[model samples]
Target: MAAIERYEQWMARLLLFNKPYGVLSQFTDRGSPTARPTLSDFVPVKGVYPAGRLDRDSEGLLLLCDDGRLQARISDPRFKMPKTYLVQVEGDPGEENLEPLRKGVRLKDGMTLPAEATRIEDPGLWLRDPPIRERKSIPDNWLKITIREGRNRQVRRMTAAIGFPTLRLVRWSIGDWTVAGIAPGEFKEISV
Candidate 1:
């Protein structure tokens, strides 16, 4: 490797954290009546910030970095890095129900780019502490969704637009990275 490249790699730190539900994506809380948990509570590493955000209600792969270029490459939508999600919607969503998401949906923010979506088997995941509400009449379905754009609450909105509200959402992968081995509130560091 070139000297500059070597130096950059030596300085770059990438951390893949499996963010738990109810934990804020940020390190600090500006203001809130309740004392919600934040990333700082779990991540001991200093000088690193989340490359992108996973809403407090969502769970799974969250990437953090101290390197500016690496952060931008992963967070910027222009890069078209795919983010895969394992979504559990409120009702059974067959292939026909997911077509609009694949074609793209129009939101108040504007039209979203097309997504790669498919039905998936039930993911035997760790239970959330409080747990999602159980409505006896409403059935649930699982879908694996891949979208390149990272918009605020995009996945939830997309599923809602298709008439299948997301009950539980888990981000399984981002680009070439996956949250396979990490458990909630735990992280693994990698140097690249």
Candidate 2:
């Protein structure tokens, strides 16, 4: 194939990555002593960039697109694509504890839109490394929260506002793609 044709073919591709904890979303981090390997370390694709960022402390699925148009479509709030997270909180979240999340919790930055769905439990999940601090006097609960917006640290902030601070946050799915069968630091390409 001609170089131009090959380039065009590559631009149409997309990849899903299960970002492990401590990795940066960007390719470089100014030689920071604590910088973790980024997508560039795993994906050799030249034009791809993350559709949205997952903080270094958070672990989960991250989407990348070689096509600039497709990246914008997936990342832009205008598209209104939803993202789901499995969050482990520090306190036992009761049905009442979920009311504010369902009703749309108000944060200092702004009122987060009500979660599309909220569940107090999810069966399949892995424990986080350097496990979250445990309080012998208190208990913790797990919640599966789905939201349309990818606000910065939104899940952690939302849970904390309700008095149950988040111990760990993991993005379980994004739009139609999921982290199923993919382990941390692994990735695969899929049709969008």
Leading candidate by TM-score: 1
Residue 176, candidate 1: Cα error in Å is 0.7
TM-score each candidate: 0.94, 0.88
User: lDDT per residue, candidate 1, 1-192, as tens digits?
Assistant: 599887876788999999999899999988898888999999999999999999989999999999899999999999999999999899888889889998999988999999999998888898887798878998888899999999999999999999999889999999999999898989999987
lDDT of 2 by residue, 1-192 (tens): 699887766656778888888788877778678766777787777877898899988998998877778888878877878899888888777778888988898998889888853656654566667667888999877889888877888898999898988888899898888998888878888754
Task: Report model 2's TM-score to 2 decimal places.
Answer: 0.88
Q: Name the best candidate (by lDDT).
A: 1
Report per-prediction Cα RMSD to one decimal: 2.2, 2.7
lDDT for residue 128 in candidate 1, whole number 0-100? 85
Local distance difference test, candidate 2: 0.82
